[model samples]
Target chain A: MTATQPKPRTSRPGLLGIYRSDLGKKYAMAISGVFLLLFVFAHMVGNLHAFEGPEQINHYGEALRELGEPLLPRTMLLWVGLRIPLAIALAVHVHAAYALTLTNLRARSGSYDGRNYLAAGYASRTMRWTGVITLLFLAWHLADFTWGIKTVNPDYVRGDVYGNLIASLERWPVFALYLMAMGALGLHVWHGAWSLFQSLGINNPRFNAYRRIFAIVFATIVTGGFVTVPIAVQLGIIG
Target chain B: MNLTLRVWRQAGADAPGRFETYPAEGIPPEASFLEMLDIVNERLERNGAEPIAFDHDCREGICGSCGVMIDGVPHGPQLGTATCQLHMRRFDEGDTVVVEPWRAAGFPVVRDLMVDRSAFDRIIEAGGYISVSTGSAPDANEIPVPKDAADAAMDAAACIGCGACVAACPNSAAQLFTAAKLVHLNLLPQGQAERDRRTVAMVDTMESFFGSCTNHGECETACPKGISIDTIALMNRDYLKARLSDRRLLGRS
Candidate 1:
C-alpha cells in the first residue's frame, strides 16, 4: 500500500465565512448592532425636534431627505446610497440573530429539571423576546410614520411629518403600544450594547463598569427620547 | 446526613432518562460528593437494584474527569470546586439534591451521570497544537519569555478540559473552553508559527458542535479552575485577525 501526495490548496475563508462559524456570526451581529445603535440614537435626536415646534420637526424631516442634495439627488440619493449601508446592516443583523437562536436551541438537548440562574442577567435571558417585540414595533413604526398607512394612523399624511406623529400618538392605543415597544427596546439595547463589546473581543476588567454605565445611559436616552414625544403629544405639549 | 437524591438514570446513549429518587441515609459529613454517591451505589447493589454509574478519576481536583450537575449548578454549587472536592457537609440534613449529567446535544448521555465529551477532543484535534519536529529538549534559557506573558499563558493553561462550562451555560456554549486552549498557546512564542491557522481552524471546529457565546459569564463561575472569561475576548480578537489576514488563500494567487 502507498500514500498519495495531496494537491496544494488555499484554506482561506471567504466573505461567506462570516456566516459559516458561530464566532464570525457573533462579530457580524456586534458590528451590525453598533450600526443600528448609532442609527437609533440619530433617529431619536431627530424626532426630539418635535418638542421645539411643528415647523422645526417638519423641517428636520425634510432635511433628512435633502441630505447630500447638491452632490447627489433628493430622496433618490438618500434611499439609494445613504441608507444602503444601514439596510444591509439591518438585514445581516436579523439573519445572524435568527441563525444564532436556532443553533442555541439545537445545542441544548434537554433543560434542567429545576433550573436556577446564578450568573445570567435579566436582560440576557429576555433578549429573544425583547428582540421580537422590537422587530414588530419597527414594522409598525415604518407604517405609521414613513409610509403613512391609514390603518396604523388615520391622520397620516404623505408630507405632514409633525401632524402625522402628533395624531398617531394622541390616540391612547397607539401610545400604549409605543410605550410597550419602548420598554422592550430598552431591555434589548441594554443587553445588546454592553455584550456587543465582548462579542467584538473588547472584554477588559477595567472597562466593565464603564460598559454597564454606557449600556444603561444609551438605552435610557434612546427609549426616553422616543417615549417623551408621544407622552408630550398626549398632554397637548407638542400641539 | 440523611439526604434525598434525585439521580438521573439512563440505560444507554440512545435510551431515554429520568430522575429516580433514592434515600441516602447515614452519609458521613466528611464524605466527598462522589463518596456519598459510592455509598448510595453500594446500598443499591445490596438491594439487587441497579447501581448508579458516574465518572471520576484521581479523586483529587486535577484530573477533571468527575462532573455532575447538582441542583442545576454544575459541580454542585461549590465555587471553583469540582464534584470530588465538594464535601457532603455542604448539604443540610434531609435536603433533596438533584444529580444529573451534562445536558447538551454535543454530549449525549452514555449512562447515569456520564455523557460523551469526545466533541471537545475533536475540537482540540482540529488545531490545538504547534507543528514541531520531535528532537532533544531545548535549553531552559533558550527562549526568554516575559514574566507576565508566561504567567498569562499558565493561567489560561489551567483549564482541565472539564465540561462544566458547557453544562452550566444557558446556551451550552463552549467558548470559554475553546478560548482557554487558544490563549494558553497563542500567548507563547512557540505557538507563533501557526497562530492564525490555529485560531481559524479551532474556532470553526468549535462552532460546528457547540452553542454561540452571549457573554452570560456563567461558564467562568462553573469552571473548577476559575478560568477567566478574558481568554474568550483574546480568542475573538485573534480569530477576527486570522479571518482577515491568514495566508491560506493568498498562496494560491
Candidate 2:
C-alpha cells in the first residue's frame, strides 16, 4: 500500500456510476439550483419594468418575445435561452430532491415520543414543503401568464402584458396567492442558496460569513421584488 | 432524587420493543445517567424481573461505548456530553424521562437501549488508515505539520465514533461522522498519499448505509466530541477532488 508506481485504475466507478451516486445527486441539485437561482433573479429584474408604468412594462415584454429576431428568429432565444434551460434545470433539481428525499425517508431512526433540535434552521427544516409549494406556484404562473389560459386568467389578453398583470393581480385572491407563494420562495431560496455552496464543495471558513448574509439578502431582494408588483397592482398604483 | 423512567425494552434484535416505566426512587443526583440506569436495573433484577440492557465502558466518556436518546435528544439535553458523562442532576426530581436506542437503518437495535454500531467499523475498514511500512516509530515532529492544520486535525480526531450524530440527524446521514474521520487524516502530510482514495472509499461506503446530508447541522449539535460540521465541508471537497485528481493520478479514467 506504499506510495509508489500507480496501479491500473480498473476498480474506480465511472462517470455514469458517479452521477448515480448520492454525492453525484447532490452535485446535480446544486448545479441545477444555481441555474434556477439565476432565473429568479433575472425574472425579478425583468419584471421591475412595472415600476416605470404600462408602456414600459409592455415594451419589456415584447423584447423577450423578439429577443433574437433575424439572427436566431423570434422567440427562439426565449425558448433556447430561458424556457428550455429553465425547464431542464427545474426537472433535474426536482428529480434529485425527490430521490434524496426517498433515501432519507428509508434511512430511518426508530420513533421517539419526543425529538428536539439544536442547530437546524427554520428555512432548512421546511425545505421540502416550501419547494413543493413553489413548484405548484410555478405551474400556476405558467398557466396564468405564459400560456395565457383563459380559465386560469379570465382577463388574460394576448400581447398585452401590462393589461394581463394588472387584470390578474387586481383580484385580491390572486394577489394573496402570489404573496404566499413568494414567501415560500423566499424560504426555499434562503436555505437553498446557502446549501448549494456546500454541495458544490465551495465551503471555506473565510466565505462562511458571506455565504449566510448573501443567501438571506438574495432571498429578501427576490421576494420583495416579486411581491411588490402584485401589491402595486392591487393598491391601484400600477393599475 | 426520584424520576420516572420509560425505557425501551427489547428481548432480541428482532424483538418488538416498548417503553416500560420504572421509578428511580431515592437515587443520588450525582450519579451519571448510566449509573442511574444501573440502579434501576438492580431494582428490576431484585424484583425478579429482567434487567434492562445497555452498552457502557470507560464511563468517563472517552470510550464512546454508551449512548441513548433520552427524551428524544441523542445524549440527552446536555450539550457536548455522552450519556455516560451526563449526570442525573441535569434532570428534575419528578421529571419523566423517556430513554431509547440510537435508531437508524445502519444501526439496528441489538436489545434495550443498545444498537449495533458496526456499520461505523465497516466504514473505517474501507480506507481509514494511512499505509506505511512497519518500523521503529518516526520522530513526533518529523513532518513539521502546520500548527493550524494540526489543531483542526486534532479536533476531528476527537470524535470517538459514538454514533450520536446519526441518532440526532433527521435524515440519519453519516456525513458528519465520515467527515470527522476524513479531516483527521486528510489534513496531515503522512495522510497525503491515500487522501483521495480514503475519501472516495469512505464516503462511498458511508452512502450505502446512510442518507445523503442535507446540511441540517444536527450532527454537529449532537456530537459528544463537539466535532464541527465544517469537517463535512472538507469531506465534500475531498470527495469531489478525488473524482477529478484520481483520474489524472491513476492515468486513464
Candidate 3:
C-alpha cells in the first residue's frame, strides 16, 4: 500500500535468504579460499627462513614466539593479533568446504553414478580428500614440531628446533609422513589457487593460461622446496 | 582422408552405452562436422550396424539440436562455432575422433549420442516465456530500446540451449543456460511483468535438476553461442530484486 511498494506482499523469502542458500555456501567457500592461499604464502615464507641456516631461522622462530608475550603491550601483540584472524579465516574456509561437499553429496542422494572429469585435473577432482589429508598433517606437525610433545625416536631430544627437524627427517617413518603430507599440500595448492582466481572473477580467457602456469609453478616451488629440506636432512646433507 | 572415429553406441535409453570404432573414408576437409558424421553413419548403415543415434534437426546451426563431445572438447576444438558449423579441415588426416553425448545428470542418454534434453524443456516450462499478450504486432519503432540494451538481449538470446555449457562446466552446471534464457526474456519491456517470477522459477527448477555452478568459466568457453557468465550475475541481481517485489504484480506464484 506504501508508495515504495508495488504490489501485494508474497510469502517468499527475501534476498538475504538467497545468500543463505546452497549457492551461498559456495560463495563463502570461495572467499575463504583466498584467505587460505594467503596463509600458504606466509607459511612458505616462514619455512624459507630454514634456508638461511640455524641462527637466522631460530631467531626468526624466537621472534615469532615472543610476539604474544604477556609483557608486551596490545600494540606489540603482532602474532596474537594475526593468529586470531587467521584462525577465524581457517575455520570458515574449512567449514564452508565441508558444508559444500556435504550439500553436493546430499543433492545427489547417495548415488555413485559416473562423473566426467575431463574439464578437471587430478588435483581439482580430489580437493576434498587432499584438504582433509592436509588438515591431519597440520595436526601432526603442530604436535610433533611445534609443541615438542611427541617423538618417534626417544634418543632425539628437542634442544635445538633445527636439530630436531633434521633428526625427525632422518627417521624413515617421520620422513614418509612428511612426504605424504607435502603431496596433499601440492594438490591442495594446485587447484585451490586456480579456483580462487576463478571465484573472484579474475579468471578470463586472457589470464587463464597465466593463472594455470602460476598455479603449477607455485605448487612445484612450495612442495619441492619443502621436500628438499627433509630429504637433505635424511641423507645427512645437513646437521 | 581416412580418420578413426569412436562414437558412443546405445540401443535405448535404458541400455548401457559403449564406444563403437569406425573408419571415416573420403571425408572432404571443407565439409561441416555433422556432414562428416553423416558419412560415418552411412558406412555404419551399409555394414548393417545401427547408425549412431545422435540428435540433429537443423544442420545449419540455428536449431541448437546438434552437438557432441568431440575428441574431449565440446563442439570440437574450434571456439565460438557450433558442431554443425565446425569444418573438417580443423582435424588432420587419419586423426582419431572421440564423440559422446552431452554428459549431465539432467540430460540422460536416450540412445547412442542422443541425450533426452527434456530437463531443459522442463526448465523452460518452469518460466522461460513472457506472459505478454499478442494481437497485431506492434511497430518495432514504437518501443525506444537503447542500442546497447538491444545488443545485450541479442547476445543472451544467442544461447541455443545445446547443453554445451553444461558439458564444458566441471560442475556440469546449467546456470549459463538458465541465466541466458532469463536475461533474454526479461530484457525487453514486454517481459517486465513476469521478470521476477521467471527468474525465481527458472533458477529453482535448474537447481533441482542440474549441478551447481561454481563460477568456473569453462561453460563460457564451451558455449557455441559464447553466452557470457555475466548473465548469471544478472540473474542473481534480478532474483534478489524479485524477493522484495510483490508476487501478484509479477504474475505467477
Better of 1 and 3 by DockQ: 1
Reference-based lDDT, each prediction: 0.87, 0.87, 0.74
lDDT of 2 by residue, A53-127 (tens): 889989999999899887888999999999999999999899989999998888885667787878888999999
Docking class of 2: acceptable
**lDDT per residue as tens, model 3, B50-149:** 8878788888777889988887788888988889999999999989888888776667778888877777887898799866553456765577788877
Off by over 4 Å in 3: A1-21, A45-129, A147-187, A200-239, B1-4, B22-30, B36-49, B89-96, B129-150, B182-200, B214-216, B229-253
What is candidate 3's lDDT per residue for A102-180, written digit by digit as tens?
Answer: 5454333112123333346678778888999988988888677766765544444554667677766778888999999
> Can you list the residue pairs that collide in candidate 3?
none
Q: Per-residue lDDT of B1-253 in model 1, one digit per residue for the tens?
A: 9999999999998888988999999999999999999999999999999999999999899888999999999998788999999999999999999999999887888899988888788778878887884345765347778998899999999998889999989898889999999999999888888899898878877766778899888899899999988899899999988988957667797
Model 2 residue B113 CA deviation in Å: 0.5
| Model 2 misplaced stretches (Cα beyond 4 Å) | A1-15, B134-138, B247-253
Q: List the residue pairs that clash in candidate 2.
A: none
Report the backbone clash tally of model 3.
Answer: 0
- The CAPRI category of model 3 is incorrect
| Cα interface RMSD of each candidate | 7.1, 7.6, 10.1
- DockQ measured for candidate 2: 0.42
